[model samples]
Target: MTGHVRPYRSYVYAYPHKTAYRPLPEPGPALRDLWRDERKDALSLYLHIPFCEVRCGFCNLFTRIGAPDELTGRYLDALDRQATAVRDALGDTAPVRFANAAFGGGTPTFLEAAELERLCDIAEKRMGADLRAIPLSVEASPATATADRLAVLAERGTTRLSLGVQSFVDEEARAAVRPQRRADVDAALARIRDARIPVLNIDLIYGIDGQTPASWRTSLDAALAWQPEELYLYPLYVRPLTGLARRTAVTDRDWDEQRLSLYRQGRDHLLAHGYEQVSMRMFRRPGAPAQGPDDHACQTDGMIGLGCGARSYTSTLHYSFDYAVDMGHIRAIIDAYTGTEDFTRAVHGRYVDGDEARRRHLLQSLLQARGMPLADYRDRFGAEPYDDFPAELAAFAARGWLDDDAPDGLLRLSPEGLAHSDALGPELFSAEVRAAMAAYAVK
Candidate 1:
């Protein structure tokens, strides 16, 4: 008899909130001190642009809707001041040698051309000329992007753009509360291509309410017509406190199956069209490396996040500031920055404490389809996976969830493993590691 597949549920268990974790110790090591010790393989920078024309129903990122020009100006000033503070804190530390710099958003295009240039200028001054060769990636909503904006980005060294093109079907877009039109995406793509930026990524979402297999196919076809250099496909995740969570319920089993099937179909389609899976959910033109794959900066090393609601990680601790546009939080960050008190202490309480270096090494490696290198693991942590996680590694291998080999030894997740990656964290990691991760989940 064939096994019965369960229907897909729209709701998923929410990860733990960051507040539950303990705060870091006071007078901890300075930013420069930390960077000096980080593995110099590669470093990257993330600049958060927290302004948005409108917030999507499924988005839980830090942003404010209908932000006026004056507010953006104030935020830019704050960003500049913060960058200076970081520079001052680094004093005599080694300069940053970044492999890539990303401007993630709310919507990066929401910023005026001047504001974007100013931010890039700040980065260039601090990170130096080395960053010019690095891929500068920025995300934009198609409706908000313009030729002038694309030109400005290209002039400032932005080489790639990730366009949020969630769905081609108007009804599906409405259901997801994304107010972009198909025509806007087409025009924006043309403008971007014309700017001579070598890479363009289109982001598509599946499993949204009102989306059917046919609608998904149409979305894929529409995206293919543009021949974007890259594609990122993600399933709808109904995050808590989002508009969609309150207004709708996701309980369609067949719809869930259709969603996964569509992802597989999309992957195959892209591959046949000459795109390769550089990583899960990411596909790029054949022989063209996905932006920053060789550096492995995002997952391998902890990044310094400088913005409201951004999270930062170091070798020993994790810190995050809640720039949620919540008046209280904003006031707290401001007060902290102005020396009303230690704002870092007040706004960004410590979320996790442990061997963050080892944790990052393991998690990032496992997340990548190719897995982690055994030698790198031993070199960093002073022990092999088998020696450190003997029982867990053995059990995982027994279940065919991970491969056990040196240099090429990777903790790859089989289909069954991929289905349970979240759960496997607790099972594979040590109790200390699990506790550190759990601490970050506290509200």
Candidate 2:
């Protein structure tokens, strides 16, 4: 930072934000060819359900509230078709294996018990992803994590179930426009435990209106009661087109300070409770059952995604269906997805060239508390990160964000670096990507 940098510039979950993606040229690369030369073994399978029971004010995820008039069934049908196409593309000519799988969305549990079974079947029969053999994870909400859904998921080998309990305090929940009582959240936790999933991840948010240090701790303790194997402490993002964006305009420094305070408090509290920091947003209990294949690395491994909201990542490209945040645009995209049939070629995506790839690898790896290994970077790119990004590394060090004491061959983030992850992560984005995002038609 030159002088004063805003801490919450943007969240860097994925490189080259979806906004950068444009329609692939006519006769875009076929899925078959896309995987023909790419590594198939140890791929990650992702199924996205774009329907949610309700949209939280702080949420900007590609999900719409409520699926009406058999919409859920239609969506699943499209997913099945897409899965079949993808499976055919990655033909058995070479090794094709799924090391891990995940069901995410508005809410995977938004479907009925039967629908949940069908969803699992699509992943298994259509895509050849052995859910039972791999680490399969699913996301749910308190209102939808019913016993029947729980039974179906457990039977199909869902190793980790992440429930979005943004806040356990009723007033704070209301402030964030995430409607749910603490009672319901508790019940959901009970159902999750009863299902015997190996890991339970509870997500909590900070910076909700009127949130205080005391209330934040209360939410943490409430979640801790379940002894969840993993905890994700998210700093609320009030992006445009979200419910909060319409109802609140909080872009002041005080809000940033408050969020930073809550974040530090939550981080220290989790550490005190024996949870290890995996990254700025992720904390895990020591020795918790690993969520996915031990060798699968997000930066290097390929991902096969199904459904409108899911984004597939090849080594050279990241692609997905039309992206939108406004409710009307989201609904229209879902409709188009359900109506489409030939799921053979990549449609909308941004190509990842070598420079972007290096940035992606470095940014994603560095955000983690464990940090990126210099040896890994050298092995992948045959060049050190410092060679590719000397100035960025220098700047991080000047700000006291880069850890000087990282073990032998690793590049790690200091506690302060981790705290300002949102700000620092975006600092690694290439200029072209920044321009694309700035000019993106967000709606």
Candidate 3:
């Protein structure tokens, strides 16, 4: 056994983070070539709004504080221009069928009610995506989940609304540097219910400084009061430039153990409340509708990401605008994105070779509650995942993290393995990718 101890938060194996991405030498032609023969049956659409009311202490996402009075309009104008160019670039690939759609980042609802409506128009009218025909998910914050915004979303076929309520206790929220009141969270929940969206997902955090088990339960129980369709319990992570990182003084191992304990408590609590464990962090009530098949399953299909922070995925490359954790750098990128007229090409991305593709498929599937199917792997790659990643799989099995002897021939994670998913994910990363990510400039 290696006896390594990782932070136990989510791992970085090619989703969300853009640290490994490099500038494409031939952006336009490269994208065209990548998408030339790509499947058009089903695709996922993502639109990012990189503006937020406040920057939380633990946030390392690509978002800036609330836009100035006229900035939102200018951003939207840029988005429209990019959408038109992207649609045009698709050429014959223009009318690809989209199975899922989402508006995320910072806060999609941070826009005014009218702006929200226009945002939907851009998705439908400009991008040629039929939001009404597919499941649509949008992210919001307690402070911004306003009545008018929710109404526009509901009318525009937003099936799910996810709210970031890191904690229900006002004191704990303050401790985490996430400014909000319990009353505001409750009010937002009520408004969401009133909007009659099919699903309501609540996001909570554990392992914050000065947080106790009692405090965690208080937050969890308060969230359960609404019987939310989905609940996500995230472990607090203090990255290099985040507010929490500047103030945090805890040892990594100690924090990891505390987070592990909290994760177990939260998982067991949700299971007792008739919620199914979708993964280490996600819980779903018994009768809640699934959040669309294509939402998280991007390995099999293509994705078109529409704003500055969003990343578009082809079969072999994932591309996005420049990525940064510092506010100044993020602003610079957003400013550059707003002025750009050409959306026909990819500027920054990482290429996925055959080996990398296999690794992605394995990582994405194995990390979920559903194990990776041996037959499916063989069908896709003409060889079992075990054949390609024998050492990694064997090591996990030896560590009691995998069910190597499952009768179904599926590679599944044991409970202990699930608990150590963060560690496992990085171990699967290619050395080259890891070095590239490590060398990335944080600011």
Using lDDT as the measure, the top candidate is 2
For model 3, give the 10-residue run with minimal summed lDDT: 292-301
Give per-residue CA lDDT, model 3, range 1-443, as digits (tens). 46765747454435534788878786445456667777766888889999999999999889999897688888999999988877666667445677888999889998999998888999999877888889999999999998989999999999999999999989888888999989889999999999999999999999888888998899999999999999988888888899888988855777888889988998888889999877666788999976775224544448888999988888778888888889999888988988887777788888778888888888788877667888878988999887799899888888888865665968888888877788788778888877887888779
Per-residue alpha-carbon lDDT of model 1 for 1-443, expressed as tens digits?
A: 12433323222111123443344466654665655566534556777877688879888766667555376666666666666655554445454456677888688898878888877886777545244588888899987688878878998878788899899888889899988777777888888888888788899988888777678889988998888888877777776567687787755666557666776777777778887665446677775545775323454344656666555555555556543434344445543433322222323444344344555566556645566767778777787766766776666666655644424554566544433343345454446544754554412
Candidate 2 at residue 239, lDDT?
90
The 10-residue segment with the lowest total lDDT in model 1? 7-16
Q: lDDT scores for all predictions?
A: 0.64, 0.90, 0.84
Instruction: Write candidate 2's Cα lDDT for 1-443 as tens digits.
Output: 46877788898878878888989998788988888888898898989999898899988899998988999999999998999999999988888889889999989999999999999999989988899999998999999999999999999999999999999999999999988999999988998899999999999999999999999999999999899999999998899989999999768998989899999999999999999998888999989998753312444549898999988999788899989999999999999999989999999999999999999889878888889999999998999999899998999999999888988899999999999999998899999999988888889
TM-scores for the candidates:
0.83, 0.98, 0.96
Lowest summed lDDT across 10 adjacent residues in model 2 is found at: 292-301
In model 2, how large is the Cα lDDT of residue 209? 90
After superposition, the stretches of candidate 1 with alpha carbons farther than 4 Å from their true spots are 1-42, 93-95, 126-131, 250-256, 294-296, 323-356, 390-400, 403-408, 415-443
Candidate 2: give the clashing pairs: none
In model 1, pairs of residues that clash are 7-253, 8-253, 16-441, 17-441, 17-442, 20-442, 23-350, 24-350, 309-323, 336-343
Alpha carbon deviation, residue 187, candidate 1 (Å): 1.2
Better of 1 and 2 by TM-score: 2
Full candidate order by TM-score, most accurate first? 2, 3, 1
What candidate 2 gets wrong by more than 4 Å, as runs, is 293-300
